[model samples]
Target: MFDISGREWIEEEYLRLHEQGLVQEKDVVKVIGVHNQMCERCLNQSDEWFGTFTYKEQLITYCRQCLDFKMVDNCHYLYRSLMPAKITDNAHVLNIDFKLSSLQQRASDFAKEILEANDLGLIWAVCDASV
Candidate 1:
């Protein structure tokens, strides 16, 4: 189950992955709730790794051994991922010379025209449907 779920501090995150067909369902029951988390700063800090905390009127869980780092609260969300394709690790180029698709080219041309005019530019699209 650990092999399938990978390593996540939250159990429901793995279950959520299973529901999304990202992980095997058989591994869900075998997954145990993670009651401890290594400090993001120092994993081998101490046995008293995790402790409950409070900040901004919200209760949170944090790494006690490292001055309370890597905190998570009620509003926090966790995502456990399966094996995913690796894209470019560091591709932070602002602009590149590449052949764009027709639709993308249209958007690019529109953006160029707007920028050339030096007016308030607005080019909106469904950036992400999931969110």
Candidate 2:
């Protein structure tokens, strides 16, 4: 079972992406599923979400609440997690023929638009452009 808030976030992200012309309606369901799976895997892989952090180190592995409050402070991780492996694989295979820079720029623009429309406080630093 998926957390309600997590599920809602995934749906919202998918819709935002669609609205930005980054992804199509047909891809929404697949993207949402992948996002949910990735988030669940990330949570399971990190013990910090449920355990305590030592005070000696300022580094604290935040819980789900903390992470949510941070609004996915790391956009690179979020982008990588949200992007389908197949797209990356295809890009690699077509590297010689495709304009990687142009594609990345478009993706960046799309991401920025989505973030702006949603009023997402965190910027996607990994993007080529800022919203």
Candidate 3:
């Protein structure tokens, strides 16, 4: 089996991997729960956004919010790896032509610090140039 941990895939991609023997049904993590009628992938539970259609003589519920990206439905499944993806400390290079404002610089610094420390944090920066 190929290493496909820590990632979610739609049904078509999952089936391709399964056909290559890189993944299996048992290894898939379903992205939606039938009992709850909620899409685990997008966490959408709005009844208005969900609809059913007949496919192969079976009715299938699908999430309209995530449909543009990929079809997430009741009869089908979203697949994720059972194992965690490997983490690396590889340095990432950023290439940008524009300079950041003072506020943006501070926010960027804070974000970098949190990532380097492997800590969880949120930075909110609001800008109103017209003000």
Query: Which candidate leads the pack in TM-score?
Result: 3
Worst 10 contiguous positions by lDDT, candidate 1: 26-35
Tell me the TM-score of each prediction against the true structure: 0.28, 0.26, 0.56
Candidate topping lDDT? 3
> After superposition, which runs of candidate 1 have C-alpha atoms over 4 Å from their true positions?
1-9, 25-37, 40-49, 52-85, 96-131
TM-score of candidate 3 versus the correct structure, residues matched by position:
0.56
- lDDT (Cα) of model 3: 0.75
Local distance difference test values of all predictions, in order: 0.49, 0.40, 0.75
lDDT per residue as tens, model 2, 23-106? 554432332122322332244334434333455554333235335433332111232223343434344333356455765667
Give me the displacement of residue 13 in model 1, in angstroms. Answer: 1.8
Pairs that collide in candidate 3 are none
Better of 2 and 3 by lDDT: 3
Question: RMSD of candidate 2 to the true fold?
Answer: 14.0
What shift in Å separates residue 118 of candidate 1 from its native position after superposition?
Answer: 38
RMSD, every candidate, angstroms: 13.6, 14.0, 7.6
Which regions of candidate 3 are displaced past 4 Å?
1-3, 24-27, 31-35, 85-131
Model 3 residue 127 lDDT score: 62
